[model samples]
Target: MLNPSHLHRLFLYGSILLSQVLPLAAQAETPEEIACYNDVQGKVAWNQKGTRTWGEDNARNLCKGVVQRAKRISCFEAGILSHNNWSKAISDCAQTGGEAITAIVPGKQCIYNRGGYALTVQWYNPGLIVFNGGDADDYSKYSTPGTPFRTEKIALGQTSCTDAANRAAVVRIIGQGFLNEGITIAVGTSVGIGTGVLGAIACVGTAGVGCPAAVAGVSVATAGAISAVGLALPEVKEIAYIGVPGSTNYLDFSGTAWNVGISNKVPLSQTRNFAKESAQTVASSIKDFVTGGTPGPRSITFNNQAGYVAEMVVIYQIYKDFGNGTIIPIPVTKSSGQISLGFSKHIDIPVEIANLPISVFINGVGTTKNQILGATVPANFSGNRCFKSFGTIFNPQSSNCN
Candidate 1:
């Protein structure tokens, strides 16, 4: 017979093996692992692989949330404050237009598109048919778990999210859309989408029949709310915005949204979005807010420069990065709305954060014909944050990145 000590030893070994095997699901989401998942939300592209290993991922991923399509009627005015003293020591700040009051005013329809999915219907209402779509992975779909689906819905600015209107269903929820998944189409609506990607040009009746901006499998979003939260992270990893540090990683892009910036040889916008949503604020992610639903822009004339821009917004404020995804927005200073921008008038917006470096965000809108002719901006590498050390150089307590 085996001695008692030998038996005890065997039992211990067996127990260790069981512990490792049994808690696979539990350990898969340990405090460290959960932290890693949350880290990648703002730093990694939603479509790209988030983690190769928990440690490698955790050590690397950092920052807040994502950016979105027009997401707001995100006009030039919105990027600035209606009033501000423009001082790092001063906390005076306020949003312009929709940012001033998103509760219900200046209605902007937004539509999001899910790239991969089996089938799903976000909402079924005929009242508001303005189209909009966005990528959704965290939400549970019947056939797929983490795979994102192209979803469509009417935004909250409407009479009511659940309220109905006599309008026809502009966005369709057919069983199969471009990728054979659920789809939303906003027909004649406008505003609340910035990126130039979209599925079909929005027409009157049908979705695919006619759709709208944000290049197809469109990506461009925003948050109606803004919070001057600090990035509160370390600079352990070379400070990446959406991906890594590089001029090409400009910011505010999803799916192939980078393509528009590439083909034009310009950076993306200076805008960054909230990667997720919170009870206190509304983010760009569709899962956080089920509500939705436009596309417009054409021609080009920056300060009378037929081909390029001449002026820019020197003031800037670092807004919160929710959970949707990251993006590039036009550069601006604390004293924003300083530039009176009109469609086709070229302007420039530059920024310098925390004495790190200077980045630029170009501005200009075009006619309704040349949909992708507006100005572009790149991510503020100077503002690329990754750690959360309290009051450290990497952690400024306010929107004062500079």
Candidate 2:
């Protein structure tokens, strides 16, 4: 219905509008893509939904000279200079919507040395720029200063082996990991080895620089030697030595086997040794006195046996009521012996007592039950009073009738 000129003008306007609208509609469909471009300050173009989200070339363009700035800032921070310069650089990075330069990267160091910066800018990404070090294939062989030293365990034995072959074996075992290598050996003061012996033992094969010519058999002396050895072998950072106890002579070969790289000492207890004796003896005089019979000389025979010769003392206590209501403890007898182990000996212990209600207590080696050898004294002595004796390791029995 419109005129030709009006129609032509309308067509031209519609074409221009279509061109602008189509591009805007495509951008509107990918909001993240728009944000990525805006966030990286137009330096990086990103296709958020694509497999390659960011172009490496774009990242390189963004980080062109940032690595050099990061290195200079880091070195300044470590030095005695005022921290304001370093702080300003970090602030600038943050203001640019990039990560703050906190540490000097290894790649940055290489770039600085080569007088150029070839770092990829991941400012919009999560991490710092990393330039390849070119020696990646040999990285495994690089030992950092933080690497820990190796450890080895060695055991020293008891007993002195005077024989050359035996001494060699002992040395071989003691120097398990450090035979050709320089090492420190800590010896206890209790060790009987002399200074000459210790030096001769330590200084073998490749003697380390400043190795002690002699080491006194003392902990302090060994420590001094260790310091000297450490100075000699600069590669060997630290050496730990453990002293073993109960090592007698060079050949006694008795000690715990070393499993771990550290030392463990175990305590040994003393062995047990003791002796005992036992016997039964009739006390006719006391029995006769209790039964109101004629008193006669009462002979007592003790069947004693000893085991494990050890010095020991025996104690005997007799309680009696001598025609009085008050019962009194009487010192009957005391004996001591250097008793032989597993041997039986006969002994005679005679006692003369004039009492009705009586009780005898005997303790041997100062240890045993029924060391209270006799039965309890009767509450009231009306019939004959007699007892059978017994003995044990703690208590020994003797014959006594009085």
Candidate of highest lDDT: 2
Query: In candidate 2, which residue ranges exceed 4 Å CA deviation?
Result: 1-200, 203-210, 214-311, 322-402
Error of 2 at 35 (Å): 62
Error of 2 at 315 (Å): 1.7
Q: Model-by-model lDDT, in order?
A: 0.23, 0.26
lDDT of 2: 0.26
**Residue 116 in candidate 2 has what lDDT?**
8
Provide the TM-score for each candidate, comma-separated. Answer: 0.17, 0.16
lDDT of 2 by residue, 1-402 (tens): 999999999999999999998985564312222333333444322232222233543433333333222232233233313333323433433323222222211110000000000111001110111111122111111111111111222211111211111011112233234322332222332211222231212221123322232332211122222111111211212211211122232211211112111111221231111121022111111122122133223322222222112232233346778775887867554333433222222223335333433333333443344243443343233333333232334444444332
Which ten-residue region of model 2 has the weakest summed lDDT? 108-117
Give the Å error, residue 122, model 2: 62
Q: How well is each residue in 296-390 modelled by candidate 1, as lDDT tens digits?
A: 12111222111111232333334434547853433344211212111122223234323223333233333222221222233343322211001
Candidate 1 versus truth, CA RMSD in Å, comes to 28.1
Relative to the true structure, candidate 1 reaches a TM of 0.17
